[model samples]
Target chain A: MTERAVCVIGTGLIGGSLMRAAEKAGRAVWGTSASEDTAAEARADGFDVTTDTDDALRRAADADALVVLAVPLPVLPEVLRRVDAVAPEVRLTDAVSVKVAVADAVARYAPRARYVGGHPMAGTSESGWSAGLAELFVDAAWVVAADDGLDLDVWRDVAELAWACGARVVPAAADEHDLAVARVSHLPHLLAAVLAAVGAGGDDALPLALAAGSFADGTRVAGTRPELVLAMCEGNRDALLGAVDDALGRLGAMRGALASTGGLTATVFAGHAGRERWAASRDPKGVKVSLKGRAPLAALRAVGRRGAVVSGWKA
Target chain B: MTERAVCVIGTGLIGGSLMRAAEKAGRAVWGTSASEDTAAEARADGFDVTTDTDDALRRAADADALVVLAVPLPVLPEVLRRVDAVAPEVRLTDAVSVKVAVADAVARYAPRARYVGGHPMAGTSESGWSAGLAELFVDAAWVVAADDGLDLDVWRDVAELAWACGARVVPAAADEHDLAVARVSHLPHLLAAVLAAVGAGGDDALPLALAAGSFADGTRVAGTRPELVLAMCEGNRDALLGAVDDALGRLGAMRGALASTGGLTATVFAGHAGRERWAASRDPKGVKVSLKGRAPLAALRAVGRRGAVVSGWKA
Candidate 1:
């Protein structure tokens, strides 16, 4: 396979990690960022960084493959416009959290770009050039969401990149990606955030010391940039609404079951069992959590390269 | 500062750990059990074990000392009955979960035992004769629940032991202890158990490999003996019920907040902050989580033992 000039927008945790991963995989990597300072920092970090979307677009215009809109959800449509205007001939993909809105937005703003909506079902609380690590995507999941009209090789190229980045490639439609994320990532973020708010809210002296590992790990994602989570929740509002309701509805029902002291006790145990499964996805060596047992090839996920195995204390 | 004979009924985790702590403290550690086999094991484990409640009664009859009912909550009333019948003149304590039930039952069955319901907020998923660790109560929280009529010295003695074991002593009324455990311990257990059951009962192919550190650590205490938790929930039904309701209520509010996605508003950030403080409680250092910052002391309350810090890279 010929090497491709891959353009990564944002240059933060996800995008920087992808640039680092692609560069590590020997792909010619380039970047753009929302801020000139961030773009300069990426340049300092040794990537060919630019805040000029047109320059980034020009760099990948002749390529058989490229990544556009490798940024936050709110700015995706603008990123798509810039890329499509300059790199309309290139095959395209995105790494957005909620794909439906972005996909719809892309269709409106960049209908000519051979765009395939994609979401790497992974990330960390860390951000920026400093957070980049090459293996961030190892064993993690990347959901590929695209309709049948795109060229077959384009889909293959994106899936291949995900695999090369050590991510498990799962195919889904745009809406399905939104739904799944709302259930898995978005809802959990909200849950953690609210738990933090109410559990420790407004108290002059927060006696949070009683909380153990579970609460911390369970709510870890909440401490990240609140704006990011808000975008995700809002971008995928309908699905997120359904997912939140599902979680609350299920928990409510479980409480009722426990109230009876008997009956189908399966639901109660099921929730814990799911948590047990999610917890086991750690990088055996570094502490990064890998989806489907493969670690991401992204640099950002490698910050906690020496991961915590809480149960590592074997008797 | 006088050594005295203390009878520990139910030679299990709480009883055995207490027996060991007491013996190490140079006190007469006498223990009993409903089963002869366990009593023998307790004796073999270096305790002065006895099945004779009458002998224990004789031993404590003339002293201002400690006697612990380290039995299950459901069985506490009957055990307290036996203690009343044979050792009615002794000062007593217990390591049981449900305070209200045990207190009410003790009032009915062993009014003369000077009983103060206690729960050493310490445990492992493993139970039985071998699960007791010397440092089990060390740097752990010991909830001392008492009514108004109790002797302050008796409370002091129990607090001293917990402190000797490197524990933080927290005073709580019966109802207070019940509610607190429901919030911090019992509710988490039930929730974890329920989640575990769900996972175990589901698609057998759910890779336990994906069950990384977070899920495992979070659910560590979930897989504990079901009967123990059942007894707790059943015994402290009122408080546990209220906690479960509270938990579900929190989950519900969180759900609504997440689904609405009115941006990364202060409401969401509040949750994140609350969780951050709560997650700081886990101190995975030498011998104590509750002993986070405390130096080796004999009778101090561990202030740093409760908060669990979450997210970010480090704890």
Candidate 2:
């Protein structure tokens, strides 16, 4: 099968990396950045990039290429408006961190577009075009939304793009993907923030000096740019709130056990078990779901729910 | 100055590492392990290791060596009892994680011992003699207790040992050290446990599949052995409880803000600032505290409070 051309909007770390990876995988790829400096940097690095959003969308529409919105949540509305104006019915997906927000924005702003939400579970704390790596998505999980009544053709295209970029596809429903990411990604960001703040404790040198591996690992994500963290976390408010409540409940029980009995056996053992479960799931057996089958979305969601990755499509 | 002979109790990761590092620094070193298997393993590796705690203490007494307690908190009192029986007045120190518990144990079991408590802030998740690294303490902070009425001579001896092991000394009171570690070390363990459990969410495969760098890093310490985590966290119950309360409060406030306004700006920014503070203090300026001064303890504590490391000491 011939690879579909990819047009990536907002050429930051994830987008820029995707453009590079997709092109390297033999797909025609071009991208745009809102920042002229970033676009010029990418261009200087021998990639086709521009700062004109409308022109990029027009090219995508003319070629019937897959249009990927890679902008942060705060800028999604404006980007969608341009997509709606130039390519209202284009094959669409995104590399945004949250799915439900992006899907909802698509529904409101670009209703006619054939959109399937996506988030590649990969990144570094660093950002901008200069930080882009063509190998960034290698061996990573790229989540593609599998809600009912979606265009299977566009869905397969998105999964193919993920595969081409060296990532395995994990198909899940939009709302389910949001909740799962809220638990695993968004909640950890908040916890890291809290841990960092508590470790700092008004900039007390003694505590920071005594901090070692655990503290460093626990707070590593807290070093991410604050605005980016706020955008994704606040964008997934409902799901994140549920995750936060769940975390707080567990913490409260842990504190009660510690204060009363001075025993963290339950908490520690449960966590050990949890970590073991994760370790066991790291190399899940591969599965395939036919996109042409009846209830394909259900099959995809089941594959994701079982922690299995779609190694390849069964046409 | 001639290096003092050192006797280490317990041959686990920290203890075994200390034995190797001290010997490399030209100090006469021998160690005892409660587990005969571990003692045999160390002995086979060409080190002076024995399972006979009484004999080791007798030798330490004969050599006027520094008796270093490197056992877990659960086994600390038993070790102290052996110390009292064989070498009640020996120059003593410890590499325990919790300072107050070990100090209290020494006070109860070996009151006449000239003890200056110490804890090297370095380790790996792995345990046992095979996991020990001679370079573990290199460029790490080793906290030595500086409470009022501590024997300055013994304190200097402990600092010298730390220096010889390639660590910089950070002098803090026993209570202060406990509190600081409670915030940085013990509390991070608990938080990691909670985060791991929440991410696992009753062994749901979806969340674990979606987990990425943040979740992995935030729960990295939860991969540690549960019993070890329970021992240190429970041993410092009072201080850990306070830190847990502080974390719970911040999480609660974050949840409130997230739920009510869907804004996490405050939490995100605070955490970013805290991470910046840690980064700024990473390469702290060097300062020296004279052991011969009238208020040397006071000077050491002040240096620690300002996050200044002891580069060297003045006689």
Best by lDDT: 2
Predicted structure 2: lDDT:
0.90
Stretches of model 1 off by over 4 angstroms after superposition: A1-5, A201-210, A213-218, A255-267, A272-315, B1-6, B20-30, B33-65, B190-225, B247-267, B277-315
Off by over 4 Å in 2: none
CAPRI tier of model 2: high
lDDT (tens digit, per residue) of candidate 2 on A1-315: 548999999888999899999989999999899888998999999888998889988999999899998888889999899888988999999999888888889999999999999999999999988888999999899999999989989998999999999998998898888899898999999999999999898445889988888888899999999988988899899989889998999999998998888788989998888888878878867786788857988889889989999998665
Instruction: Give one digit per residue, the lDDT tens place, for model 1 in A85-203.
Output: 78766778888787778878878888887777777655666777778888988776566664545554566567667766777655555664565565555655665565455445422
Residue A50, model 1: lDDT of: 80
User: Residue B205 in candidate 1 has what lDDT?
Assistant: 22
lDDT by residue for model 1 (B53-161), tens = 6677567666655888887776776677777887786788888876778888878888876666677777766777667777787766566664566655565566566
Query: How do the residues B30-132 of candidate 2 rate in per-residue lDDT, one tens digit apiece?
Result: 9999888999999898899999999999999999999899988888888889889999999999999988888889899999999999999999999999999
Model 1 DockQ (Cα-based): 0.23
